[model samples]
Target: MTRTGSPAGVLSIKPFRRLWIALSLSSFGDWLSILALTALAGSLTKGSAENYAIGGVLVAKLLPALIFGPLAGAVADRFDRRITMVVADIMRFALFLSIPLVGRLDWLYIATFLIEVVTLFWIPAKEATVPNLVPKDQLERANQISLTSTYGSAPVAAATFSVLALISKVLFSQPQQQANLALYINAVTFLVSAATIFSLREIPKQRGKVSVPSILKQIVAGWKFVGSTPLVRGLTIGILGAFAAGGAVIGIAKVYVKQLGGGDAAYGVVFGMVFVGMAAGMFLAPRILQEFSRRRLFGLGIIGAGVALALIGIIPNLVIVALLTALCGAGAGIAWVIGYTLIGLEVEDSVRGRTWAFLQSLVRVVLLLVVASVPFIAGVVGNHRLHLPGKNIYRFDGPNAVLLIAAVVAVIVGLVAYRHMDDRRGIPLIRDFVAALRGEHYTLEESTREHGVFIALEGGEGAGKTTQARLLSIWLRDQGFDVVMTREPGSTKMGMRLRALLLDKESSGLSSRAETLLYAADRAQHVAEVIQPALRRGAIVVTDRYIDSSLAYQGSGRELKVGEIAEVNRWATNGLVPDLTIILDVPSDIGLTRFASPADRIESEPREFHERVRRGFRALADAEPHRYLVIDGTQSQPDITRKIHDRVRAILPDPVPPSAEDETSTMPAIRD
Candidate 1:
């Protein structure tokens, strides 16, 4: 059966579920702590100094990343992830508990700095450990769940803080004491997280081999990798840009709310709305934009955020500002998930921790700069009142100016990043975006194929692919159209040699990776030498096997990641997908029985292998029914061929000559 890694399916893994729960609790605590900390900073001073004080607190929280972020990834790599997380959580618990008890601004700064230092190490370890907790197929879904839990807890945290604020009002008169209840709760959550992480045995233990030179080398290598890889570079820029936009909103939110004649409760609601939007974005992205290219999606998300932020600055109403903030959060949320998922899939385990640390470090640095400076800048610009003729007054202050400027910068960042990493360059953005909204995968019509058709027949061992291919080619040729019939693994001169080595039963001990690569190489040559050339000349290019065959036979049958295989094939074929892929579906046993000759190297595989291949085809077809035609191989040869022909005719290029159309109507039925 085809595996659908839904949210429920991913959460069903016991260890992952535990980790997710722990993360949720930890995230709730972290969000609650942020509110308490910022509120405490605001309470520490009055008037213009409040912005400065809040900026100082944020700077303290993020400054450690600049100093220690590079080494944190190496720490995750060189130590046990579980132990690292547990220890960090314990440290944070103590630090948070001391904050309210100390009741001093200096102590708050010191504790905040220390908390961030511990967190820098904890985050990399946590992010790197996640991939090991679930199956590869479920990795993306797992990330969606993890991120949802992390940010989804924000609203809960906000609600809890609001309740505590009310309780503190009745119980205590001091401003510092008002935040004490929330701080104590935050401290308790870290302890809970520590205990939960201690129980998960699934997080793989890393080698504790530590050396100064090795550490330095890894840090350098990590930087080099980020700098050298275009995809990584673009993703880093995109993610940082998204966070900068978010951070600007966060930094000014408290004071901006007050400026709109709102109090702490309104600020809490605004904060909660951002997370609500983030949660909604994470939950809905996969379903709504499932067919959209992730690269383009990431950029679009950032642009949407920038647009919303611009509006947020211009709109004066508190309720509308909150709604706009949610929209901004939604965009940032989409970009965050896609960017992280791409990194997880692209980065290897050995360097994964370091890569995450690098990204996290930059994110913190961006947040630090944005939060530390934007508020101060807003204070510098101060508030201004514009009077209208009808006795209406509009407030256009430093916050509004700052937000508009940040929005422009964010949009530019998104455009640059999009241009750097876009895979579908010639495709129109608006057309593709609309198609994605409608749940369609749109590929720009290739200019090379003036009137050509590309078709592939895919199936198991004896699914009559060869017979169908021959009959289809003859029928098309009889209609006065040029047809090039081909098959993979023996389609070209290089493929002929590859076919012998691949199919010979004596070729034992051939590794799965080697076999996959060999098939890719053959397909690469087949497309370049025969397929593309035929299609460019406006001929009907029919092939017995194509990219899908490798996806089924090697990807699913060998238990390799289908996505990895698809990526390889996509590169090999230069992103040339068939206009139509016909899968001759049949039961493995029945298909095997039809093969008269002794089984080849592939066919000789156990019955279970073929079953996987069959399921893989069905899954592929199910994913894109618009581009596939699945036929029962058990049907009469004539019946199958007629069905295939009808489907092919619908997609064929128009402007058929009058004689060709006349002959097509009178065409004889295809035979096997």
Candidate 2:
């Protein structure tokens, strides 16, 4: 959720790094095998039989997932994940090595199917293991890195295959021999992956007895959970729709390219470009749309893909088609990464393996159906050309017509899925998108237990922040809420030292950047030790000050960039924005005069500087009016307290109704 930091932080975890490397190697090997097996299949047959042979190999590779996916997922959930992955990899290595040694078309199909079956088990285990290795908040960034490795390795694999092909041809002078060498190398990659996974001790093993009935029960439960949970159901449908669109594009691409008067080379370039766009979207969309809700972004990506696919059918220019294809790929990339991250964040660890397996199985089935059907559908549609006015020719083909239909379906899927899965409800999608484009920071309401309400009181010197915070804490406690009264820069034990350094007059000469960093250090510790833990325990936390103080005093008053300071604070707090911030508005001169004694370092600043600080608070409130409650600090203490109570009451859940006996027993008077 903290978009300010680089994704490199996820890689800093040694265990995740090891898994990432294994994933990359395995992915590279997978792509390489695709090329090698296809070529080998062609070589094993003659004339038109070669085409059938290649198609058979492809089908054999994909069909196992459809047949064995559920069982694979069950196996992953029932056993030690590290052992599951290692065993899967070892099986893959052995099967891959056997392919060339057997050297028969039938044997090739058997080996390919076996390898894919093992891969199905490895994938779910890997997906489930990732969330355990990284912190919950860092799941998005970790998913980003995993996805990049998953898809980004394709180009490298293609290049490696080409190099291997050249070397084999020059050394052995046999095309079949070259294909065999590539397979041998691909086999080695799986061995390396197995060795790597074996070294990872962090992947927890399933405890207690494992049985067929229990595994089946878990699988059934996983399916039921997916079907019953609206968010998960919506995510599943959206992911399938995205895959359907992609599968259609891939299945019909060869014919579509020819329809546009292009050859194999054009098809290759277009294919490569789509993945290039996908990599760009995965890596850059987070930074570009940093402020947008992840749920909205997922929906938008699906919509974007649908729109691009629709446009590709309408536009006749091949270059334009290429661009549209790239855009579609980019949208798919964003949706894919976000969807995976959401699963990790939302799903429980106990059922995570089975849930991921169900998703994986369904995805493979949908992809296979779309990939198998699209080509046939396009073939049936055929081609129709009409000569129009102004020497323009209009061509309607099977690919074009099928694409238009797929686009419509995809759009409908996106709209429905968006409505169901949007976590930030009531915020219009277009407004959120525009706000994100402008880089405005906002809070995303996660669908977690509504455990606590965080209210931050901000004001200049002598503006009664401490008094208001204390009053709110007491009122909340009286209403039967567990209240934690705290303050920034001095809340935790470590923060006490930081607070002294920040407030002491001797530290007045501290550099602006250093002062800013000191505040950030205190805030980081405060959030970790005080804020997050209390909130997790369902305690209402009322703090005297938070990030806004830095924004006001250091950012605006010191003339430093507010945006940079905001990013620093965002990183420090790991994107934990307060639910509500009450800004007690008071004139700088009057507020300063109310302080009867010597001022602290921040308070001792000039009146103009304090005025700038006041304006800073006002600007923030204006930007996010819903989150901020601006009150006149000059009002009576009772009046200010009543106003805050009203606003907070509207946000909090209604209190439980007391029983008649309890009501009769407790008729205590309200305190001033």
Instruction: Write candidate 2's Cα lDDT for 518-630 as tens digits.
Output: 99999999988888888887788899999999988887677665657877887788777788899998888889988767888988888877877787776566435557888
Best by lDDT: 1
Q: 2-52 in candidate 1: lDDT tens per residue?
A: 122234468888999999989998899888888889888777778877777
Q: Candidate 1: global Cα-lDDT? A: 0.81
TM of each candidate vs. truth: 0.65, 0.54
Record all residue pairs in model 2 with backbone atoms less than 3 Å apart, i.e. clashing.
Answer: none
C-alpha lDDT (0 to 100) for residue 234 of candidate 1:
77
Where model 1 places Cα greater than 4 Å from the true spot, the runs are 1-22, 68-91, 118-148, 166-177, 191-220, 227-230, 344-354, 441-453, 456-484, 487-541, 544-577, 580-672
- Cα error, candidate 1, residue 6 (Å): 7.8
Q: What lDDT is reached at residue 660 by model 2?
A: 39
Angstrom error of the Cα, residue 73, model 2: value is 6.9
How much does candidate 2 score in TM-score? 0.54
Candidates' lDDT values, in order? 0.81, 0.77
